[model samples]
Target chain A: MATQIRELIGNHKILPVSMERVRDEDDLYELGMTSFASVQLMLALEEAFDIEFPERMLNRKTFASISAIDRSVSELVSGRA
Target chain B: MNVAVNPAALTTPALERMARVADEVAARYAADVDATGRFPEETFAALKRERLLGCWIPKEYGGEGLSLTEICGLVARLGQACGSSAMIYGMHQIKMSSLIQHSVGSPWHLDYMREAARDQLLLGSATTEGGIGGDLRNSICAVEVVGDRYRLTKQATCISYGRAADAILATCRRNPDAASSDQVMVVCRKGDYTLRETVDWDTMGMRGTRSEGFELVSEGDARQVFVQPFSEIAAQSMLAMAHIIWTATWYGIAADTVVKAQAFVKAEAKKKPGTVPPGALRLAEVSASLQQMKSLLVAGIARYEEALADESLMNTLSFIAELNTIKVSASQLGIAIAQQSLMILGLAGYRNAGPWTIARNYRDLLSAAIMINNDRILGNTSNLLLISKIDVSVA
Candidate 1:
């Protein structure tokens, strides 16, 4: 899940930084992930995981890092399972 | 099952009546509006008198309940008379459509739509901000919540007909803490907001639009904030409608230029008794290009209608790319067709302030490409192209 999240972030091109340099715990916004890019990343994540981020989850904290995204997705997926 | 119908069928007698009123107003004030860089008050008043401002809102909401096709035709006809009026009308419809679709269950928007239907309110959009550099999806200003009320202050790079509009639909970050892209669209009545002009609008064309920059400040009930995400709104309706209707209006400008060109050719041929005017062939070519422009707009409008029926399809990246491409294509074709018309008429079209003159049409059409900047659209399309798996080639 972490690997997939990282891949999606790197490939989404919302951030100016490259994928390899984007650490799991690094703050995506601080690393150049713009609000526009975050939306793109959210869409990509939704498409990849087949889960919609509810309004409550649509905050800066949810997309702060690849690790954060993976954790959120895991929770949603586990809840559904 | 998708049923395709001629978009023109969407027009009704009421729309035709409004178009006539618009035409009369445009005929009287278009030139002066262009010359003075003033809003077309007469044209807007005509629209209001005809109750055409609420054309796109649902009938349940006290509007005409016109479809996108009908709205496109109405805007196109208005464009044929005056670019500024058409653009202003188009922007209003775009905002109205967004509210109708995205704000479905929200009582505030519904009530607002009903009021707009009754009042025929002219709406201004303040999405483009100064520091953002034309990236509409992001904003530097945000909604500041204070108790039950929300305050917004934005340095809008441009607000079309800002001073003239009765209300504004402005965008800002969902909250001060939200990301620049996590924005919400807020509704502000003219009395609710204050504007200080930041820049003057003096341009070569579409001058009547009077798109001046202003610092917009508004404090309103938090309920004015649309509940849906801006991203969802853009993906579903706003972007597509803006592109489609703008395309239709651009087509209208081009069609008018062709009409003038044909008249010029016919007049020249009449003087010569039997010989064809040298420009006759060019007129035919321009006519063909005009047909192509119409096809692009029709295809775009049709696709939008189809997507409108299917919520799932509307949310996809593929649909977004298709709409953007249509915008880029329509804008380019509009400019090209107008340029061709100018060439066909030569000095006659070049002359300012005459029956044979297409100078305003030519200048107005030039604004299409730079309205949102075609290159930016192309770049976004290219990025989407990298991910789009849909086969674009015709069988």
Candidate 2:
């Protein structure tokens, strides 16, 4: 799941730096993930995990870091189980 | 689900009073304001006298609590009389909408709104800086925090009537080292900021706006900064409000020219007694364009009002595309309507002297497409389309 998340982030071009150089805990916004790119990343994750994020999850904290996104996707996918 | 503001309230007695001010004051000085390239002081003076400047602050804040729709009607009327004055009004309300909608547990902002209602403070916007290249989301200058105080220096590309405004809403990086995309909005009251003119606002139209550039220096309590990131503010309020409100003003500009064209056609028909003037068919054609433009605006307003309760809806791909569509369509329709009016009036419309003179309207409407640059809007819309479904259903 973590590898898939990183792949999606790279595919969406969310980071100015390569995923290999980015730490999972690094702040995505600080690493240059714009609000524009954040939306794209969210959609990509939704499609990849086959889960829809509730309206409340559409915020800065939900997509703040790779770990944060991983946890959000895990909750959504497990909730569907 | 969000009907906190009933759309029916758009036709209040306050709207009528505002229209009267537009007709009597704004219309009277429209020509001189344009020619001299200055702010429409007398028009705003009349608006201030009537306490219309802060009329949108909620009734709890000692205001009339006018809805965005009502403000739209008033703005369109002002657009008919003077584009510059209408722009100033529209821009201020956009800032108000931003503050009102995105307060985020901050009591200072609420107190400020109440103060605005009682004291009638005119708000100014310093969003576009010297460097962002027209993107309001990016800011190079950062606010430096020293103890409980914060200060920022920005090369604002334009602050419409900055010198005369009571307070200015400025955006900058969250801190000295924050990235360009990370920003916060800070409200600087008049005494907290100084605007030194760095560029002149000599232009063909909207000259009365005095949208001059300045080196803005401002400092205030850190509590003045909005809690929400500038991105959320843009996604939720500023985008929808700015597009809808600005388009309302442009729609009024287009609608006024249609009225002039109808009057021109009627005068010719009266001269010929039983015969219809050749311009009658042309009038019929242009009126259809105006209806289409109005439909676009109505849909945009309805969508925005419906999304009032859901911040996520306001940030959706579909809502973003639709609002941007209203702006692009209305900007084009405004200029086309003016051109068709000139066609109906010939030299009478071209001249600046007669009652049928549409030269000012033509020049002002020309700024519509290029103001925010329709190309940029359409380009942004194009990106959204790539990632989302274009779900258009009348049901």
Candidate 3:
């Protein structure tokens, strides 16, 4: 998951920010992720995981950090029932 | 379903990012910017830092290398937040796309594009001539080649970011003969140009664009001419991209209109239950219109992306014209939805400090139908459809 996040950031040219520097509860904005860039990251995560993020999850709380995104994706993947 | 889509073509991520930024900016300065006709410099600065400005520049040029679909989606998001800014960004992307499509073997053009990808430069088109009246007027701006330099002079109307644009993509005619193929698009720096501040920009909508009249009489080396004949298959592809982008912007406006109206009605319904029914009903109608517009825009983008992938599809003028019809349909529906939402929102919406985005977008979105040759696009679609019925063999 960390490697995937790193790869996505690299793809978008979101430089100088690393996965290790990102805390689970840290604000993505503080990590240099603009709201727009976070959306791109979410989309990238969707493509990478082959999951469709519900429009309901299009909020900042769900995408605030690497852990938050991972948790949300896990739930989404597990909620397939 | 796994179609091995080119990563360069999908701007889903970029669109997502830009959409959020747009929302923040819209929330912050939409009212002030519209009321004062002030340029959304803060929004643009945000875009620059976010690298949203380079969303369509090729990856080779340090851009996001996004497809037209993604670019359009991003522009629409921006339009929702600030229409004038979105229009300016759209014009800049189109100009950049044009430069990329043409300009073969020119280091200077490549360097300019590279700069555009990073801090780059701001660009706007000087295509619409003031005296010419319409798109049909042969550009009176003449370009005379002298040795390695070209001198140009002409008036440009409806130039977005005219006063502040770092560079103007000026179009001119080099051939004296009407039959001669001398129409060219040249990239001229601001250093060689003077902006005639005759910008009479008072309008019912898109007031923040600073879209005013300006003239340029400049001298540039032949290398400054980015594109000759000013037309190419890629340029055509980019136009298709542009149409899709315009569609997305309108879709965003319509969506935002419904959102704000629904919020207003929901809040008001609790206090005054009887009057809120119509607002709720209007919200429902606008919501339906927004869904339809989104579906059409996404579908049209997919088709355009597919066409861009296949070189043979450039000849599909009729198909492209149909896309224009989709745009017209979406824009008209969007504007109507916005107007209805505004009416439902009532006096609050019309007030300078209204909570609804519909007030500004109601005017800004209307520009889609009036932008150069938009009406002609509809005519072309109708003519092509008529011809298709008469000549069954046509592709």
Q: Which prediction has the highest DockQ against the true structure?
A: 2
Distance from true position, residue A5, model 1, in Å?
Answer: 2.5
Per-residue lDDT for B393 in model 3? 40
TM-score of each model, paired residue for residue = 0.85, 0.90, 0.73
Q: Listing candidates in order, what is each one's chain A TM-score? A: 0.94, 0.96, 0.76
Predictions' DockQ, in order: 0.10, 0.28, 0.01
DockQ of 1: 0.10
Error of 1 at A38 (Å): 7.9
Residues B290-335 of candidate 2 have per-residue lDDT tens digits of 9998888788888998888765566667788889889999999888
Winner by DockQ between candidate 3 and candidate 1? 1
Docking quality of model 3: it rates as: incorrect
Say which prediction, candidate 1 or candidate 2, comes out ahead on DockQ: 2
Question: What would you estimate as the lDDT of candidate 1?
Answer: 0.82
| Candidate 1 lDDT, A14-54, residue by residue in tens | 77767887788987765656545777887898799888776
DockQ of 2: 0.28
Winner on lDDT between 1 and 3 is 1
TM-score of candidate 1 relative to the true fold: 0.85
